[model samples]
Target: MRTSKHLIEQLASDLGYEYISDLHRPQLLPEIQILISSYDSQSYSLKEWKDAVQYITGSSCKLCECEEIKQYLLSLKNS
Candidate 1:
C-alpha cells in the first residue's frame, strides 16, 4: 500500500503536533506512514493502534479524545 504524505500530515496535525517547515518530528512521518500502511494491509489491531497513537503523541490520554484517530482505529478494527 502506498502511504499518503497528506494523510500523515493531517494525522500529525490532528494529533496536535507542530512541524518545522515540512518536516514532522524527527521520525514521526515514517512512523505514522508505517502505521497507516500497516492498517491498510490489515495487519494492525486496535491495541496496536492505540499504542502507536500514544507513542506518537507522547500521551497516555484516552484515544477517543481524538476523533480522527478514533475513527481511523475503528476502521482498522472493522476491517
Candidate 2:
C-alpha cells in the first residue's frame, strides 16, 4: 500500500518553513510519489516506507518502511 497524498502534502506543509526542508530539496512531494509507487501488492509496513525512501531518496531509515509512517510521523509534533 502507498501513503496518501494528504499525508505527503501535510508533511511538506509541516516542513515548509523549516531548515531541514533544505535537507531534502523539492520536499516530500517527490517522495510521496515514490512511496505510492513503492507500495507492495501485499501489505504495507514501516519496512515498506523505508524501502520506498530507499527506492527514491536512497535512505536506510527502515522506520519509514511502514505504511503507517505517515500516521506515525504525524503523531509526533514537528515531524
Candidate 3:
C-alpha cells in the first residue's frame, strides 16, 4: 500500500522535480505528461490512487492538476 506522500514523491520524481520531503509538498512541473503516461500503468491500486488524488487536491498546491487526475482516475474506475 503506497502512502500519499510516496505517490507524490514518485510523481515529482517522474516529472523531474526534486521532491523535498521536509516540506511534504510535491514540487511538480505544470505539465501533465506523467499523468497521461501513467494512465494505463496500473502500478497502483485503486485505494492508492484515491489517496494520491485526495492528497493532491487537499494540498495548497494550486498549480496541480488534481481535479483532472481525479476525473481520469474515476474514468479508470468505471472502465
Using lDDT as the measure, which candidate wins? Answer: 1
lDDT of 2 by residue, 8-66 (tens): 34344444534334325434545444444443423544554454344435445545235
Looking at model 3, the pairs that clash are none
Candidates' C-alpha lDDT:
0.46, 0.43, 0.46
Displacement of residue 14 (Cα, Å) in model 1 is 22
| Preferred candidate (lDDT higher): 1 or 2 | 1
- Cα lDDT, model 2, residue 18: 41
lDDT of 1 by residue, 1-79 (tens): 3444444354556545676233325454554554465344323344444565555444454654334564543343211
Alpha carbon deviation, residue 77, candidate 2 (Å): 17
Candidate 3 Cα outliers beyond 4 Å, as residue runs: 1-6, 20-30, 59-79
TM-score of 3: 0.43
Candidate 3 total steric clashes: 0
Error of 1 at 47 (Å): 0.4
Candidate 1 accuracy as lDDT: 0.46
Where in model 1 is the C-alpha error above 4 Å?
1-27, 30-38, 64-79
